[model samples]
Target: MLAVALAAQFMALLDAFIVNVAAPTIQSELHASGAGLQLVIAGYTITYAVLLITGARLGDRLGHRRVYLFGLAVFTVASLACGLARGTGELIAFRLLQGAGSAVLIPQVLSLIQRNFAGEARVKALGAYSAVLATGAAAGQVLGGVLVSADLLGTGWRPVFLVNVPVGVVLLALAFRVLPRDDAAALAAGRARGLDLPGLVLLGAAVSLFTVPLVLGQQEGWPLWSWLSLAAAVLFFTLFCAYESRLARRGGAPLIAPRLLRSPGMGLAVFRVAAVMAVNAGFLFVVTLHVQGGLGYSALRAGLTFAPSAVVFGAVGLTWRRWPQPLQRALIPGGFALAAVATAAVGLLLRDGGDGGLWLYAALVGVGAGLSLGFGPTLTRALATVRAEDAADASGLLATVTQLGQLTGVACFGALFLHRLESAGAPGAYSSSDALLVCAYALASVAALGAVSGLVRLRR
Candidate 1:
């Protein structure tokens, strides 16, 4: 059961970064504009983020096993569609569908872990899950590069999407054979409560309004509608919160339980997760573009550039269990510090059109190590206070915010990268010093915040 769950998780997170390495190729081949390419990536993340909380609720109401299988099937079909897409619009549409499938499957993995494991065993399982998440992300870059570069049967970038099909099939079979049967009584109870449709709709609208404009504005030259959409997003989200509060007060199950917000450490966890994930996503996105689009490296070369960082990340994960508690706590800020330094170093290397040599690659390894140190610890800390009954909700909320971080990172950073590129009047030119320097500074600020938070926790 654990293996099957991890396999599904690996696939979901893999898709997130795999498309990143292939982004330039997708853009050139499909004649996609800068904004269109952003959409191809951010669209999936936005949809996944929006539906995550609701998907978790559905799994709680429905059987986790049932929902997991259904979502796997949906994701598999969507992968096929993505691979077969004939245009930019079609690809984005299928990617959105793919996100929906991911949203459905992801929370179940965490919930299943909580259900199946206990005490120390549960902690180890959670640790393993985090390791898998990190591995999937790092592996995506390497695998995507290999698939696209190999161009097996001349399929080019299409194989990246197609690769999920066979893997999904085998997981589906294994899931059925190994996963525990759903509790019939629990399913009936969940069905009795029904879904909060209005809440779901409001949440979706709120997210779409905020994300769509950010993604489309730059490409479309920031029209009036884009500004209007941003404003509307604020209003819709306010309304959703107010309605949810009211619903909770009236003895009803709200979309997000109001009580969950009151749980100790929940808010801090959410913020830290958002900040770290944003940095991770933005850094990877810009680096990929810089290497492939700016430096004129092939997809394989760009992918290889990230290999050292992936290795360092895996090494950190493997050794983390042995670290002293004080050192373990410090790893969060320490990792972020490494990331900030690494980004700055890379920016210097790329300044004035300099070839980023082995030194730059060394910085990337630092970034990966920093990511390994920060991400898992922050996640574990965030969920430490959550009760078992609320595991599904907490998992959903965490996953949602994590993806939102990725979406925000890609949207905001991609916009900056594109704006800088355009202003330089150099097509295919990447100004890492301008855009990446800002990103580095932002990451540095986050690291400082993490350090302060760590100190406060220690005093308590």
Candidate 2:
């Protein structure tokens, strides 16, 4: 059951990053314009983030297992369509479909774990889940490089999407055999709330407005439309909150629980997750650009730079349970601090645009291990207080926020890095390495804030 769920999840997450290394190839082959290429990439994430809560509610309203299979089937078909697409428009449309399928399937993984596991076993499962989440992102880069470079069947970038076809087929089979249907008790709990369409629409609009701008603003050079969209996002979100509050007053279950954030440690823990995830995303973006675009590293070598972090993160995630209880608790904040130091070291060591050597590799390794310590425990604790009935809500909320955090980090830090480069011009102006140095320092600062937030949450 676990293998089936994780494999399905890894496939979806892999698609999120797998195109990065192949973007150039895709653009060339499809005769895609620059804006068209950006759309091909951002459309998936935009829809994925926007529709996540609705998807979570669907799992609750229907059934997790039912939703999982349906989503897998949709995702599988979409992957095939994406690979077969003959034009950039077709590819972009299919990519959006792929994201929607992922949104539908992913919430079930967490809901299943929370429902089925207990005690230390639950902790271990959560750790493994976290490992899959982190590792999937790193692996996509490496695998994308390999698939594009190999040009399997001379198909070039198509294999990245095509690869999901067989895996999804297998997962669909396993899901039927292993995934449990909703029990009477779970069904009763889930049915307590309707789909809440008005709330769903409001929240979806808010997220779409917020994320679309972030995804496109940097490329568009932060045009007036982006700022206006952001302002409208705030308006829509305010309306969403007010509507949700009204729904609660009317004895309706809100799309998001009105009181969920008020639960002890919940808000702070979510913030910590958001902060760390943002920094992690920004780190990946800045470093990728620095290595490949600035430092002139080959795609394969640049991808390999992230391998140490993925390995360490997986190792620490799987093994964290062996530590003493108190030590495990201490590690959350300690891990954040460690991540901050390592991130700062990376900034300093690579400031000159040279490979940071083995020390840089060690620092990258620390990045994953430290983040694992903080993220896995924080996730466990955040959901610890949630009711089983609200598991889908919590999972969807966290997943959506994590995705939003990545979007925000990439937009904000990516822009900052570019701005730095623009300021340091050819009249002895800044290089891409200088921009990277600045972004790395900023990422370290965010890591430090995550540590502080972790410690503060512990006291509560």
Candidate 3:
């Protein structure tokens, strides 16, 4: 069961960074524009983020193992679809399918762990999970490069997605044999409680309206419809909250309980998660582009460059549980500060055109990212007290926000830097110091925000 969960998590993490190394190749091969490439990556992320809550509920309604297997099967097929895709359009469609599978799979793993484990055992297990997660994320960038550069069977960048099939099949087989059956009586009783259909619709609509427009607007040049969608997003989300509160009053299931949202610590944790994810995702996206395009490094080199950070992050994650309470509180903010410093250094390095020990600076960025990302599991365990019944919902909401944060980081930060670059007459290609500097400052600001959030929690 653990193996299956790990495999699913690994696949998702792999997808996140692997695409970064493959982006240039994907663009050149498909004759894709910048927006097209962004979609290939962000489209999957967006869809994955939007459906996270719904997917978790599916696991709750049906058996978790059932949902897990279904997700793996769907993901495997989607991987093949992505591998075989001959155009940007086809690839994007396949990636969306793949994202859906991930949404289903991810919630179940945490849900299972939360359901099964308690006390010190749960904490230890979570620590291990977080370390693996951090390692997988770092490894993805490197592995993507290796596979792409190797051109295994002349598949080029396709092997990154293609490689999941064999692994998925193995997991599927193991899952069938090893996964425990759900308590049928419990499932039935739970099902008697109504699912929040209205809440689901409103939430989905809200996410789609908010995300699609911002992502597309930048590429499509901020049309009137984009503005309209943003407006609709605000309206829908407001309605969703109202409907959910009413449902709670009526003695029914709301997607996420309003009571949970009222927990100050949990609320702060959610915001912190969002901030960290945004910074992490945005940093990876920009840095990957900078290293490969700006610094003239090969795909393989670019991936390998992140290795040090992966190691540190993995190591830190393992020891995080042992840290004292004050230190644990400080880890997140400290990580953010480190990242900010690293980003600033990288910006300076780029300004100097990769001269004056830029590689050293790049390595620092990796260290900071690793340190920051390593604490995610511990933080999660801290928040919400790892309750059994609420596990799926909590994990799903966290995952959703995390993905959304990543998307937001890219959309908001990338858009800002790109705009600044354009206005400054910076070259359209990725090598400009102007863009790098802008991204650096943006990351720095995010770091400050993370630190502030962390401190607020500590004071309270």
Error of 3 at 404 (Å): 0.4
1 versus 2: better TM-score goes to: 2
Candidate 1: where is the Cα deviation over 4 Å?
A: 23-42, 86-90, 184-189, 192-194, 425-434, 458-460
Q: What lDDT tens digits, residue by residue, belong to model 3 across residues 186-247? A: 47744765578889999999998888976677778788998999899999999998998888
Model 3 TM-score on a 0 to 1 scale: 0.91
lDDT, candidate 2, at 170 = 88
What TM-score, computed on C-alpha atoms, does each candidate reach? 0.91, 0.97, 0.91
Q: Comparing 2 and 3 by TM-score, which wins?
A: 2
lDDT tens readout by residue for model 2, 1-460? 8889988998998888888889999999999999999999998898899989988888887888999899899999999999999999999999999999999998889888888888877777888898887677788888888888889889989999999999999889889999987777787778867788899999999999999999999999999999999999999999999999998999998998867777677888788778877877888888888888787777778778899988888898888878887797688888899898888888888876667888999999888888887787788777877777787898799889889888988999999988887887742213887888888788888888888887773445
True-structure lDDT of candidate 1: 0.79
**For every candidate, C-alpha RMSD to the true structure in Å:** 2.7, 1.6, 2.8
In model 1, residue pairs whose N, Cα or C atoms come closer than 3 Å (at least 3 residues apart or on different chains), thus clashing, are none
Q: Model 2, residue 381: displacement in angstroms?
A: 1.1
Which of candidates 1 and 2 is the stronger one according to lDDT?
2
Q: What's the distance in Å from true for residue 232, model 1?
A: 1.9
Stretch of 10 with least lDDT, candidate 1 = 451-460
Residue 409 Cα positional deviation in candidate 2, in Å, after optimal superposition: 0.9
Tell me the whole-model lDDT of each prediction, alpha carbons only.
0.79, 0.86, 0.75
Residue pairs in collision within model 3: none
Candidate with maximal lDDT: 2
Task: State the local distance difference test value for candidate 3.
Answer: 0.75
